[model samples]
Target: MNNADLRQVVHANSGTTCQELAEMFSVSHETIRLHLHQLGKTWKLSKWSHMN
Candidate 1:
């Protein structure tokens, strides 16, 4: 997916951890984290402990 779509996905799932998001997007967890960090939404990507 494109960056915009990725951003939307992340925004839509507030409590999802990077790992979960990565799984959903078929990408690596670190890639998801990096994308969010680049998008300035690292705060939106929940830490592992906060994931449901």
Candidate 2:
């Protein structure tokens, strides 16, 4: 899947980490962060939260 797909998955599943997602998507943690930024989003509170 693509970065956008991976981002959606992470967003859907709360409390998912950049490292974890990176490993799953075979990309660097920074790459995930970059995508999130491009999407105008980010994991809040330094930890993933279920609340949107």
lDDT per residue for candidate 2 within 13-48, as digits (tens), equals: 857888988888899999887776666666787665
- Span of 10 residues, lowest total lDDT, candidate 2: 43-52
State TM-scores per candidate.
Answer: 0.69, 0.69
In model 1, the runs with Cα more than 4 Å from the true position are 44-52
Q: Rate the local accuracy (lDDT) of all candidates.
A: 0.67, 0.73
Q: What's model 2's TM-score?
A: 0.69
Winning candidate number (lDDT): 2
